[model samples]
Target: MDDTGLISRLGDVVGEANVLVAADAVAGYLVDWRGRYRGTALCVVRPATAAAVSAVVRLCAQAGVAMVPQGGNTSLCGAATPAAEGRSVVISLARLNRVRAIDAANNTITVEAGCLLQRVQEAAAAAGRLFPLSLAAEGSCQIGGNLSTNAGGVQVLRYGTARELTLGLEVVMPDGELWDGLRALRKDNTGYDLKQLFIGAEGTLGIITAAVLRLFPWPRAKATAWLAIAAPETALRALIALQDRFGPALTACELVSGVALGLVRKHIPGPHPTLVDSPWHLLVELSAGGDEASLREELASFLASMIDDRRVADAVLAQSGEQARRLWTLRESIGEAQRIEGPSIKHDVSLPISRLPEFIERADRALVEAFPGIRMVTFGHIGDGNLHYNQSRPTAGDQTLFLAAQPQVNRVVHDLVDELGGSISAEHGIGQLKRAELLRYRTPLEIGMMRAVKEALDPRGLMNPGKVL
Candidate 1:
């Protein structure tokens, strides 16, 4: 498709300088964060407002050209990356970064789509409320991308995913019409909940321009702890005990394998935690609106009990805010550390909480038998049954040769994921990376319903084509 006319119109709507056509200017936007997918874009446009986004989309629709909505360009699944074959326009939402409103009484924050997740969290904190949606990319990832992917972070055990925290969304439909559904009400059952279609659609159905997000009371005190555990089963026992004792106060439960933690220690440049011998570790946190000392004392007591039962080999409780942050840094740095270490096959799968031990035991044995000397860097929000089970090269080899086994590796992991009655994707949406896997795992009827909605909203598929469905 010829994008010259559409390009000029987009420039007119968003301003001439906002339209970037130079290869160097648009090169960074065409590639995903993981350096996995690279594509071609005719031009990159920066729209600062919802109106500009609408006009740009309309122009693209009129010219029969495709558009890709990009925010922060931090998509691990290449959802924000354009198709390598198509001359699509990349709509960069970075210019729309703004906090539009914060209703403290209503406990809601209305932010433009391009606002970073960290900024939203800061805004909520400034209002004495907490926007609990967080992840490793929160520092760079935009709220629009997070909503589009339905991001789940460490605190998901308590606050839930982006879809749950989101109250409303303002979307730019594929036909260039803007739908202002930014209602912050908790209960609104008038008709079809249109926002749900666009949230996790990964911009295939529409482009999310702004959002009204739910907020919560800020935790006055929090106690963080790290446990050296023998196995996933032991972690599960500790998880159950924490849930029974702390209940809603149990905010985060993370599982980190020794190899995964070693990567963070070796590459991330920080003092690693003291528990070095254990093969598996659990990082957990409890937050409440109470005194700090009492909370830590309670957690310490629980840790002692866990040790007595031999479920925990050792435990380290954070003594101060700095200590707690250091503990969190360890859990959050796994992804970056993995990137620095080398290329690996990644899987973000979820299973029934009760079946996690069995899934891990079976998957590990199966993978080792298939690919000898393969390194499994496994960790995730075990509280929510999500595991970031990744496999890396054993010691040293051509990166290309190791990566060639990706398809075969995925089959071994994903086939077992299917057999265990688990989902292939838990947090990340079916972006380009998982599109084929999505088709292979999801039932035909479920996919049909999804396609029906996509067709109804984006008939020509001009909005972020070649992504998701």
Candidate 2:
């Protein structure tokens, strides 16, 4: 279809007021949040309802124009960004923000695609439940994007990833047919779980309209502690011991590297007074239904035993809830600190919990040996074996030269991740950034199967083309 004709059709679907055509107005939606990729779109369309989204998708599909689905545009990868070639229209789901229902009895809350992550959290909290998907970008990220990426956060040790937290989804297929499979059933083994297809598709297969998310009972008591352990291995041991002692009460077990902490101190401003300098620090939290004193006592006893056994060198328990939030603030600040330091090669890979120690040791040694004077900032949910293994620019070198080595660095890191029966892309889905790497790492059969599914669903390849498979 001609450019003029295409714009006219899209305007009809979402109205002219909601269609953005000015270059300056569409600039922010063109590039990704991390500036890793920059793309072009003919226009940006904001549809407030699923019906409008379907109409927009159908119009674009008929015009042979690709459609890029965007939520909060908080992707670390370029998943939400459109292609550089101006043959697509970015369908921003920001206008579909609404809380449809909250069923406390079923422990579920249904929300539209545009609802902010923090907003959903607040809504759940107000309803006396916890959303449990906490992340650094919670304040800005959208629930649809979170589900699309299947985001894993600090609480994944207990609550699981966004995929697991989601019970059902309402998506518009590539052809613009609305699939209303939003039933909050705990057991449905009737056929293939269709919702799983779009959950982590990164908007390639379809646009997610809304989701039925699982909720948990709000914790009456909470406890947090910072432990200085000998190594990641010790942190792992302590993690198991805490689980054995507290069971489901253990909410979060985050591993922090001394290098990661130092980055925060050097790059980020202000005093991180609650932070304890150690080779490795573990931020542990317990969400319980009993008294706070009992929760603290349980965690303190576990840490005391670890300290006596030499697994921990030092430890500090949060005296109050405010102190606990302070401890968490430091962990959340690591990403921002690194961002301020400047751009670096970031990898969100995951390995088996048992093999995490070896993966870290080998990957660290390999990267350092291959590239001298490289800085390794490692920290993540060690309990779930997902590490945000990132490499900082050399202190004394050309920044572009170091950044240019991304391919080699990814080869080294991703090869090891594949060798250890681990995933090259963990919480962060394979958007455009890792699309080529995904083809190389994933087997041809697997790739063919993914392609088949994509072809079957998006026959014309109009839904987020140039993305995952």
Candidate 3:
């Protein structure tokens, strides 16, 4: 149970070189991606295989030491960071990076949890397939964390969230037992889908070692456009029309506020005059198994009709692939721009598509009334009803003062989210940042059932404590 013995046992399971005991080496594991949370860990452990991870977990469980499973440490909600108690070990799965198999015939990619999402996408592309789970952090975030958080990105409008993309999972349970459920089958209705339990559990019930993910045919032809809409209501109507015209070809339909675009233009360097000034913008993309020329023509015709009908004010279609990438870069840079600007209160919530307009209107009004002259930077996967609704300090105000109002700001935003039957934590998991909020929003019975399940799986609570339930 002593620290020395614990480190030695962990070293024996993995290797001495993989066990980071010094403070300087473990510093990165302590802090989160957003620099919002910093926690202490007894040590950082690198396990390169499922067997090694299982051994590490068994040792930690037997010693009554908690284990925080981490991958890339790219969590938005501090889900992968350790607590400040300095009693837990941070198990980094980055060493387990590997593509176990790529079955183009079965349309699945079996990969270790440590594989970066972009790498997986690349691997799929090399094999003439598409892995659609993508976000701004795709370059660094790993598949394990993506599944743990059930991440939703712009593509969720077509491909669904991480949970939907997952076909099977290989997990190391809390007690250090390996549950090799990595079956790539599409249908096996034997009983309860146990993998679902750990998908969005935030590593509390177990650690995901690998996964079998679904893949789609590579998009043959694509079209991207930026539409200047009147408001969120207009964006919704545009989405319906686009879907009706293109059906599943409509791959992504994102809503970006003018303020969000302004931040990108101000903070990030890029070409100017590419898009017309507008109150709200919708970045829409269509992917189809047809000729590129035909797809572009169809999208152009659709835009022209929308403009004539007054559904869209003005629109510009990407003339080339590079132009499309530039348009996407604008949508993806909002988060980084916000960070560069200053400290802000960020909320990742989802509402029914029908209620999104009302939710935005009410939340905006209430926030401005509560904190006069507050700036709202709202944008996200509108087609999927998930919004990254964030607030920044007024131009003349201090960030310290604005940050101090986070708790109050959260109440105003979350209360309205509840009334609208939306989730407080949509794509983001209930990590340390939202643990209390989860308790407040979830019903007593719901919380009790979650606790019961947690107790049944991790009775000692040695798994990632202080997260989720």
Candidate 4:
């Protein structure tokens, strides 16, 4: 399509005010949140409604101009960012924010894709329920992006990922047809089950406009604890013990390496409330709709036994709700702390929970041997076997040279993960950054099947092209 002509057409479809073509105006949408990718877009279009999204998509498809669907623009893997060539038009779903319905009895809330993650949580809370997909980016990340990546957060141990929290979706297919599968049905044995296609497609197959998300009962009783563990394996053992005692009430169990905590203390401004000597820490939360005193007492008794057995080195249970949040702040600050430390090679990989400790030990040893003085920050939901295994700059090497070896470093970490029946990209989807790695790791047969599905839904390949499949 002619550049000027296409821009004019898009402006006509969504109005001039919604169509952004100026370089300064479109710059923010071009680059990714991590500043790792920069793509040029002929323009960026903002549509306020599902119908507008369908129309703009249809217009772009007919013009043969590639389009990118972006929400919140918080992707660490360049999923929401455009390519360096900037040949496509970035469509921002931020203006499509709307809450369609909320059924407390059915335990579902229908919302537009542009609504921020925190807004959804607040809406659920207002309805006397909870949307348990809590994450550090909850204040800024959007729901559409959450579903597109099948996001896993601190609460995934109990409530599951974005995939589990979702019931239905309203997507604009690549061909511009609206798929109205936004039903609140608990069980519908229909053929094909099409809604699953777009959930984690990263906007490759279609653009998610809205979703019907599942909600849970708000917990009345909650207990949070910070434990100093001897090792990762010990943390794993304590996890099993706590699960046996607390059962379903065990909501979150996160592993935090001392190295990561060190970064948090160094880069982030704080009093460093946690002792600097603990080798590893576990942030454990138990939530229920029962008596708070009973839950706290039970957890304290369990921890005392664990300490006696040498599973836990030392521990501190939150004495009040504010203290519990303070404990969680340390866990949540790791990402920001790393950001301040400078660009590093990161891998959000996951393995079988049974293989987690071994995977960590081996991967750390291998990376350290290959890249001496490389600071390895290993921490994540050990209960789920997902580790945000990241490697900081070596104390001696040139920063540019070290970053240039990301692909090789990724191979070392991902190879071990693959050998242990793990995924290279865990909660994060195969966005633009990992698209090539995904192709390298996935079998040809699997890639063929994914391509077939993508072609079946988006034959024109105009919706979020150059992403996942």
Candidate 5:
């Protein structure tokens, strides 16, 4: 049980090269992606297989030491980082990266937890399929972390979140037992959906080692367009109109604020005059199985109708694939632009589609009233009601002073989300950053149920302690 014996046993399980103890070596695992949290660990363990992960977990459990499961270290809310006590061993899944199988016939792909999301997408594409769960961090974030957080991305409107895309899971329980429920069946109406429990648990009960994800037929034809809308309400109405006309053909509908677009234009260099000056914009796209020319014509017809009806003020349709990518570049560059500006309070919340405009109106008014000159850079998957509502300090204000008002700003925004029957933590799981907020918003009975589940699965709380429940 001593530190020396523990390190030796871990080294024996996974070679000494895989067991990292030097401060300089494991320093990256200490802090989170946003640098908002920094925590020390006893050591870092790299396990390349599910069996090895189980062995390491068993050793840690016997020694009464906790294990923090980490992948890619891309968590925006400090879910994968360790604690300051340095009592736990961080298990890095990076070495486990592998594509187990690609079942094109069944429209599924089985992959290891360490496989990068972008890699999975490429594998699916190679098989003539589409793995639609995508985010800005797709290049670096692993599938294990994505499933653990139940990530929602731009394509959730057409496909779904990580939870819905997952068909099966292979998990290492808290007691170091491997549960291989990696079945790729579509209809299994047997017992409880056990895999669902770990999908959004944030590694509180168990560590995910592999997963089977659903795939869709690759779209042969596509159309991308940018519409200048008057406001959020107008954008919502336009979305409704498009859905009524195109239905499932409409793949993505993203809402971006003028302020957010301006940030991208200022910080990142790219195409100029992406859109005419407008208070709000919608980056709309459609995918179809028909001819490419027909798809473009349909989208053009729809946009023409929208403009005639005044639902859209102005618009620009991409004439080629390169132009489409350029338009997407504008939408995706907002996050990096905000980061380049400075630190700001970020809120990932969701609301009823009908209530999104109201939530924005009320929250924006309240924030500006409370802290005058505050810059609200708002944009997200409007098709799904999830908004990345963030705030930046005034140009003349002090950064530290602005950050000190986070709690107050959160209250103003979250209160409105609650009043509108919305989720304070929409796509992002309740990592250490939002633990207190989770307790505040969730009812006592709900919290009690979650606690009971956690206690049942991880009695000793040796799996990712101080996270989630």
Candidate 6:
């Protein structure tokens, strides 16, 4: 059987309209949102249900064709994009967007793979619950992609990562077997946790069709503050103070660099807030069961204490929900601001909270010395130690030249991260971007163990080929 035969067979399983091969129709499926990865696909298949997905996978697997499971195509590392070979069939889960069920009593929601993250959040909110996995692309990113990458967003400090929130998953195995593991039980230690393997596997083992996600009680009140700190050390002190004072109510603690803020202010339109000029800033928030006024007063009191200690140089407290959103806009727009600024090497790295200050100082010193005039745009979820440590080309340097120096730049930053006990890729999975770097950082034995698991689950190596080991 050839590509035509497979396409026809897939059409038979799904409708012919769902099997898209036109240049315009499949264009978006071939490339990543960052435009860093571009690939060719024989066709893009849209399966509307788990059973249909199983049929499509069975046909493709029997035809010896590779399958790339894609959702939302919002991957920072090109995890959801097909390879340049163009021989694979991109199994898009977009048509599977649906809310399976919501069990408010059990604090769980079962959602299909293609359900937009924002949609899931809205559904939970409508049911008087909170689904806290939030990211800049939540409006466009899908639940399957979130689970596949084990996404960690701004609220990870309080709610946890996608893996921790996911209670069960429905996966279509590489060989076209359907594994219906969508059990919403909070505790079932029967044996090996199978759902976990597929959660962060980046679709190598199987295609996630649906998931049962954990939910929480909605916060009755919220207090948001934007604190201007002198440096990362000052930011750390503020984090400790906020955690000590508010405990779990301290939901988010984001660190943004002055340089990063400048880009957002310059490129992104704003009624942006006015604050004292500082080298670094911390976007802090506290949400708990109380009235808004009292929460704000408590947060204001804590800010006052910080001001006396000089840990916080200046602070701006949001008096309303609208103001809080504007503050969040500043922090969330860093990536897009960097995008509009220009192309450069990007690192989604994480370090121990205590080691972050040292890592930043050492890495900054080393990178500047080596790259001479490189621009750093850095910010991240301070509570979780994940930093979106990105770089831009020198003010007048050619983009091509700066991009070519990526490997050398990576060595400098990634080497230091390893030295300080950090991760090369944090929230972002080890997709095509970090495939080579994974071997460099991980031991051969560790890689072997991963390979063994992949082999056992997907012996033919057809599932999301050429990604994550």
TM-score of every candidate: 0.98, 0.98, 0.98, 0.98, 0.98, 0.99
lDDT of 2 at 223: 92
Show the lowest summed lDDT stretch of 10 residues, model 6. 78-87
Candidate 1 lDDT for residue 377: 97
Candidate 2's C-alpha runs over 4 A off are none
Candidate 1 minimal-lDDT segment of 10 residues: 1-10
Tens-place lDDT digits, model 4, residues 1-469: 6878888887887899999988889989998878888888888999999998999888888888888999999898888887777468898999988888899999999999999999999999999999999888888899999999999999899988998888899999887899898988879888877888888889988899999999988899999999998788888898999899888999999999999998988887776565537888999999999999888988898899888988888889887898898888889999999988889888999998988899988988998898888988888998788889988997677889889989889999888888999999989788887888888889999999999998888787777777886
Global Cα lDDT for candidate 2: 0.90
RMSD of each: 1.1, 1.2, 1.0, 1.2, 1.0, 0.8
In the range 236-313, model 5's lDDT, one tens digit per residue, is 999999999999888999999999999999999875555799999999999988899889988999899889999899
* CA shift of 371, model 4, Å: 0.9
Tens-digit lDDT string for candidate 1 (1-469): 3567777777789889999999888889988888999999889999999999998888888888899999988888999999999768899999899999999999999999999999999999999999999798899999999999899999999989999998899999899898999999999999988898887889898899999999999999999999999999998988998999999999999999998998888899867657656899999999999999999999999899889988899999999999988999998999999999887889999998888999889989988998888898999999999999999887776778889989998998899889988998998877899989888988999899888888888888788888887
Q: For residues 1-469, could you state the per-residue lDDT of candidate 2 as single tens digits?
A: 7878989888887899989999889999998878889999899999999999999888888888999999889898899998887699999999999999999989999999999999999999999999999999999899999999999998998999998999899999988899998989889998999999988899999999999999999999999999888788888888888889889888899999998989888877666655556889899899988899987987888789888888889889998988887788889989888888888899999999888889888998999999999998899998788999999988886789999999999999999999999998889899998999999988999999999999999888899998887
Candidate 2 RMSD to the correct structure = 1.2
Clashing pairs in 6: 40-86
Q: Tens digits of per-residue lDDT for model 6 on 1-469?
A: 8999999989999999999999999999999988999999999999999999999999988988899999999998889888998479999999899999999999999999999999999999999999999999999999999999999999999989999999999999988889999999989999999999998899999999999999999999999999989999988888887888889999999999999999999999988998788899999999998899999998899899889888888899999999999999999998998999887689999999999998899989998998889988989998999998999998998899999999999999999999999999899999999999999999999999999999999999999999998
TM-score of decoy 6: 0.99
What is the clash count for each candidate, in the order shown? Answer: 0, 0, 0, 2, 0, 1
* Residue 397 of model 3, lDDT score: 92
lDDT agreement with native, every candidate: 0.91, 0.90, 0.93, 0.88, 0.93, 0.93
